[model samples]
Target: MKVKSAATQVHREQPLVLGYKVDIARQESVKAMYDSLVEVFNARLDSLINNTAQMEPYKPFLESDPDTYWRTWEVNIQGLFNMARTFFPMLSEQSLQVVYGEQGLWASCVNPGAIKIKITAGALEAVRNVLPDRLAIAGDTIAWLASDRKEWLGGRYISCPWDMEELVAKKDEIAKEDALKLRLVV
Candidate 1:
């Protein structure tokens, strides 16, 4: 899909919709999809925006459906792992790998984030009108990250709504400390 500000709508690029959901013919389908993608862009990627996700119903662990929970884990977490494992090496030097799961993160604790909205009017929709990360913000941030200067931001879980000025101020420290990257802290 063409994601951009209204002014930039004139530009359009092919979107690759490859996914593992259709397991009946997933391997063959994925191979065809990737083959075309590799051919179109010569197997070179400037940036890979992985927004693939699934969310389980809000419930206690014991009450939650095992199938539903695992599906969420498989798609949101494992999906990223698989995509990265296969596609990351295609990243050109100074390219980006972004997992935008927590986009508009300030809007909620976050999963299947605030990006999509169910429109209702004159109702009890306590719509989050604050800290709302506009679609443009996410688009702009992704573009910024796709640039060479933001290379250090790679291999991380990036928040689309992170305070830009604060991040800019701490950019040096972030790079130096290798902060904001995905890591498991003991």
Candidate 2:
């Protein structure tokens, strides 16, 4: 349960897995971040997942530099890529079930305003296309189509107490996906 900057390496002796806070503002930083993470978890981890809310706000420089935008994209988008590729095999049904418990916070389109919505939505779409089913996805907010259809990676979408049941239902859906996706193996 240790949280560290993306640049840091995971500590091998720590009993709990490591979580890196990525800054999606620079491309090189993203590469450096994942490279370091991969190095640590290559053989040491039993399972791997990410808490997307850990991504920091988009910096003003992110818009100014095309390279930076793509870098942010890599961190937000490719970060998932690296995580899945690096740790997909280690994830199993039991491991996936408890991996994300109480560790995530749902993000709202209003939390960081409209810009985050666009970026997060774009990244989410990209991951959905390439992501393998073996890993579990946990997130704070559930994105829905205009028809109220939930996205593939389900989570709670609303903030009020009345929505708790809906959130629980969505959580169940995600858990099922986690199991189905990993069905090929144990």
Candidate 3:
């Protein structure tokens, strides 16, 4: 219901916006979405933000249902992988435009720092004890990322709590250290 309401609101704001229910964990579903998108936009996509995730109810691992625990991994990891793999061609097509000096793709995994949403309000009530960050922190960060302003951050993980100006200042250092990527630390 929340998803539908959000979609309706976006469609109201932008008449061209199209919404479809998809199970990202399924390859066929992802393909259908890709097909629909290709048909609508004539095989052109400027940007793709893969933001599908799932969280099982907060519980101890030993007490958690095995299926439910794995489901979160399926949606969070496999779903994101499926979306990225399926959309790579269209995304690459957009990148090709860079040959002509046009702005290209800027993709990243955004961690919208602990904002209070439906799930947070319910399943994550423990967060209620802590002050949640404003929605604008994530919204503004994503808005900046959608623009051509920060291509260097592509293929990186970005936290909404990080200051963009500070991030930019340390871009070289970040690249040198290959930071912001998932890696095992000693």
Top lDDT prediction, candidate number: 3
Q: Which ranking of candidates, highest TM-score first?
A: 3, 1, 2
Question: What is the C-alpha lDDT profile of model 3 across 104-156, one tens digit per residue?
Answer: 64556689987766555436466655746887898788767776646567668
Off by over 4 Å in 2: 1-47, 52-63, 93-95, 98-162, 169-186
Candidate 2 backbone collisions, by pair: 27-71, 106-140
The models' CA-based lDDT, in order, is 0.52, 0.40, 0.76
Candidate 1 residue pairs that clash: none
Residues 43-116 of candidate 2 have per-residue lDDT tens digits of 33332334343333334653565765556576666665665544443443224311233433111221222233
Regions of candidate 1 where Cα sits further than 4 Å from its true position: 1-29, 92-132, 155-157
Please give each candidate's TM-score: 0.61, 0.33, 0.78
- How well is each residue in 1-186 modelled by candidate 1, as lDDT tens digits? 333443357665445544344321233544455566688778876665665455454556688788876766776676666655555556533233433333211111112224533321222335534325566666666666655445445444557677666777887898888776656679
Model 1 per-residue lDDT at 98 = 36
RMSD of 1: 7.6
> Could you list the CA RMSD of all candidates, in the order they appear?
7.6, 13.9, 5.2
